[model samples]
Target: MSARLEVRLDDERKQRLEQLGEAEGVPISEVVRRLIDDAWEEVMRARRIAAVERMAQLEVEDPPDPETLSRELEETYGPGGLS
Candidate 1:
């Protein structure tokens, strides 16, 4: 569900938005919603990218090698290890 929003813009901005909406064959509100949604999507994408990069950094700081892990497990438990 969505609620109605009433915003007051300067005359020049309102006219420009109206003109753009007309050229795009859509309502001014739709044009504004599209612009806002696009900006929000970009922000979210950047945040996700930053989170992935942070996770990569953390992984590099505490890395686990498969070969060393296998050898340690075999030495501790048995030849077949946990399997």
Candidate 2:
């Protein structure tokens, strides 16, 4: 389902949107939709970045030993020895 949206833009912004639409071979509405999609993607990307940053700041207690992790990896992926 699609709903209609009415936005009031200044003359300068309107001209810019028109030029962008012309350059992209699309209508002004298409340009607005693309802009909205781009904005939404940026918001989602920011959320992911924030989540990663939060996780990075966390201190994990009792972390597993590197040697144990290596042994487990080798067990799961098999030895690198030539058969």
Segments of candidate 1 deviating more than 4 angstroms: 59-68
lDDT of every predicted structure (CA atoms)? 0.92, 0.91
Question: Candidate 2: TM-score?
Answer: 0.73
Clash pairs, candidate 2, are: none
Q: What are the runs in model 2 whose C-alpha is more than 4 Å off?
A: 65-83
TM-score, each model? 0.74, 0.73
Instruction: Estimate the lDDT of model 2.
Output: 0.91
| Residue-by-residue lDDT tens digits, candidate 1, 15-62 | 999999999999999999999999999999999999999988774555
Model 2, 1-83: lDDT tens per residue? 99999999999999999999999999999999999999999999999999999999999787569888777777877785232
Poorest stretch of ten by lDDT in candidate 2: 74-83
Question: What TM-score does candidate 1 get on C-alpha atoms?
Answer: 0.74
